[model samples]
Target: MIFDPSPIELPSSYEKVETTGHVFVSHYPPGTPAVTPVVIVTLNRPAKHNAFTPQMVRDFEKLFPMFDVDERVKVVVLTGAGKTFCAGADLEIGFGVGKDRTADHRDGGGRVALAIHRCRKPTIVAMQGSAVGVGMTMTLPAIIRIGYEKGKYGFVFGRRGIVLESCSSYFLPRLVGHSNASYLVSTGGVFPPTSKHFGDLFNEILPDASQVLPRALELATEIAENVSPASSYLNRALMWRDTGSAEAAHLIESRVINHMFGSEDQKEGVAAFFEKRKPNFKANLDDNPPPSVPWWTEIDTGRSPKAKGPSKL
Candidate 1:
C-alpha cells in the first residue's frame, strides 16, 4: 500500500523508505520539500518501546544522508510508533550483538547514531516514551527536542554499567549543563519531566502526544518557508561542535567500540543472540577500558576516526 504523506503535510518530493520488515529503515520516504515539512523517520517497534536493534541503526545511517543531501528536505522529525519514542538499547541482544546476519550489519548501530548526529538538516525529535541509551544519545543531537507529557526521556547508561557510548557524553552536558548532565547520567533511568527546568533539553514539551506531530510540523514548515537551509545547517553544526559534544562523542565511541570488540562481553553477546538467549557478559567495561575523557573537557577537534573524508557529493 502506498502511504500518503499528506497528513503530515509533506511535499511531492517526499518518498517512503521501503519498510520490508527490517528494523533499520522504517517508514522513511524520499526527501521532499514544500512550504510544508515532511516526516521522514518513524519508529515502528512500539511494542518493544521502539527499542533499537542493529538493523534500525543501519537504516538510520543509510537514510540520514539522504535528508542531509536533499536540498528540499527542510526539517526532519523523529518519533516512535505507539506509546514510547525508543527504549534505548535492546538488553537481550546486547545492543547489536547478533550474528552478522548481513555482512555490514555488525556496526550498523554505531553508524546510524553517527549519521543522526552529523546530519546537516534540522532535526526534531518528538518523544512520547522512554528514550534510553542510544535513543537518548540520538535525541540530544537533534536541533529541537519536543517531549510529550507522557513521554519519558532517559540517559540510562549508568544502570547498565557502561559509560555513555553513543556520543551523548558530549551533547548532554552542553544541552543541560555539566552539573545537570552529571546528575542525570549518574542517576540513570527515567528522568523527571520538569518542563521549566529541563525545557533547555527540549524546544518545547507538549501536554500530550496528540500535540507533538502538529507542533513539530508547524515549526518545520516555518523553517522551510523562511530559513536558509545552508545557514541553518551550518548553525546547527556549530552548536553541535561548540555547545553540543560532537567531537568528544567521536572519540568516546571509537575508544569504546575498539575495546568492546575485543571483550568477552561482545563474544558472549554475539553467541547469545544467535543462540536466541540473553548474553552472559562477564567483563566490566570500566575494568577493561578505563574511563577516559568527558566531552566537556579534553577536546579532540579532528575529523571522526571513522570518517576518512567526505564522500564525493
Candidate 2:
C-alpha cells in the first residue's frame, strides 16, 4: 500500500517555534479519533545523501524536545527525506574531530542520542537506505526501527579509526546481545537488516524502502489512537529504564497499576470496550495525569570518570 503525507496542523504551543532547516517537523491533524496524533521529523539534506553534520546534530537536539513537551503529540516518527536515511557523519568537515581536548567537550552524535533516549514520547525510526556510523548508532535510543530488505547498517567507527558514539555501547548490547554488539563494532562490517547475526534489530523488514515510513506511521497511529498517553509514556519508561532488575520493575509496575486502576483513562478504556465505541479519553499528559506519572525525574547515565589528578610516586 502506498502512503501519502497528510496535511499537518501545528499545535498552538509550537506556533512560535521554528520548524525549518535541516529537519522538518510536522504533526498529523488533530480530531482523528481512528488515528492517533503523530509528529514526523525528516532529515532534509537529500543532495548529500542526508549526511550527518554538526548543524543537523544541533537541529535534532532541538527538535525532539518540542514534541516531548507538547501534550498534543503522542508519537514521533523519524525518517530521511531522500532515498538514504543518513550516510553517517560528514567526513569533509572532520566530523567527531575537535581541537578541544577538555573533559567538558561532548560528542555531537551523543547529544542527539541522549535527547531521543530521554524523550517521553515513543519514537520510531524508518531506515530507508544506508545508515552507517553515527546514523546507525543514533537510532539505538529510539523505541522501534523499520527497515527494508535493502537497507544497510553498520557500526563503522573501527574502520574509520574512531570509536562508537551515541551511547551505542549501552543500547546495542541490550538490543542485540553483548556478543553480537562486540562483533559488529569490532569488525565494523556493513550488513543488511536481514543478517542473522543482527537478530531482531529491525522490528519489521519490508520488501522495499517505500514501505518503511508507511509501516512506521501505521504503528505510530496505533499507539496514539489505541493506547493511553500517560500509560504509554510510563510503560515505555518501565520497559526501557527499569528492566534491569525484577524487583525494580515490580515496584514501578505496582505503583503504576495502583495509580491507574481507578483513573479516568482506565475507566474510559473499559467503558469503551463494553459500549463498542471509540472511547474519548479525557486524560492527557498536560492535564489530569495520574499522580504516579513521571515515575523517574532524572536520568543518571553517569559521565565517564574524570582524569585522575597528577600523582607523585
Candidate 3:
C-alpha cells in the first residue's frame, strides 16, 4: 500500500523532526466510533531498506518523546517505506566510532530502544518486510508488533561478531522465553515469521506486506477510541516492571483501581457499555496517570548503577 506523505498538525518541535525527511509522520484518519489523531511514523529510507544509522537514532529520540507528551497523539504506529522494513545497520558506515571509552559510548540502537520503551504513548510496529539485527531488536520495545509472514527476522549479533544491542538481551528473553531467546541468538540465523523460535514476538503475521499497516491502523483506532490511554500504559508498565511481592502488586493495583473507579473514564466506560456505544476516553498519561507509577527501582537509562526513583511518575 502506498503511504500518504502529506503532513498533519504537530507541535513546532515535532514538525522540525518531520521536516528532517529521515522519517515520515502523519495523523491517521480514524474510522467510525474511533477518535482522531492516531499518529503514523514511517522510516523514509526505502533506498537503503531503512537501515539504522546515528541520524535515525537522533530522529527517533526527538520523535517518540514528542508523541508521548502530545495530547493530540493517541497512539504511534511505525512502519517503513517500500517493500523492506529495515536491513539492520548500514555496516558500510559502521556504528558509533568515537574515541570515548567503551563505557561511555552508548549503543545507538539501545538509545532508540529506550526512547520507545519509556514513551508513555503505546507503539505498534508494522514490519511490512524483513527485519534483521538492530531492526529486529530495536523494535522489541514496542508494545505490539505485526509482521509479514513472508519476511525474515533474526537476532544476528552473534553472526556479526558483536553482542546484542538495543537491550534485546533483556527484552528478547522476556518476550519469548529464555530457551527460545537462546536458540535464536545462538543460531544468529534469519528465519521466517512462521519459525517456531520466534514464539510470541509477533502479535500477528499477515500473509501480505500490504496488509501490515492497515491491520495495525485498525488496532490503533480501536485503542484510540475505546481504551483509556492512562490505563493502557499503566497496565504495560505494571507487567514489565512490577512491585516486589504479590502483596505489593495487590496494593499497587488496588490504589490504581480506586483512582480509576472515580475517574471520568471509568464513568464513560460504564456508560458506553450500557448504552452500546463507543467510549471516548480522554485520559492522557501525562495528565491522568495512576498513582505510584515508577514504583519499581529505576535504573538509569544511561546504564548507570545509581538508583533514582521508587516514587511517582
Q: Pick the candidate with the highest lDDT.
A: 3
TM-score of each: 0.65, 0.84, 0.87
Q: Residue by residue across 132-154, what tens digits does model 3's lDDT show?
A: 99999988989899999999988
Clash-forming residue pairs, model 3: none
Residues forming the 10-long window of minimal summed lDDT in candidate 3: 304-313
Q: Residue 304 CA error for candidate 3 (Å)? A: 17
Name the better of 2 and 3 by TM-score: 3
Candidate 2 pairs with clashing backbones: none
Clashes counted in candidate 2 amount to 0
lDDT of each: 0.60, 0.76, 0.80
**Clashing pairs counted in every model:** 12, 0, 0
Off by over 4 Å in 1: 1-16, 19-37, 96-110, 195-199, 243-313
- The CA lDDT at 275 in model 3 is 99
Q: Local error of candidate 3 at 117, Å?
A: 1.0
Tell me which of candidates 1 and 3 scores higher on TM-score. Answer: 3
By TM-score, the candidates rank as: 3, 2, 1
For candidate 2, what is the lDDT? 0.76
Q: Among these predicted structures, which one has the highest TM-score?
A: 3
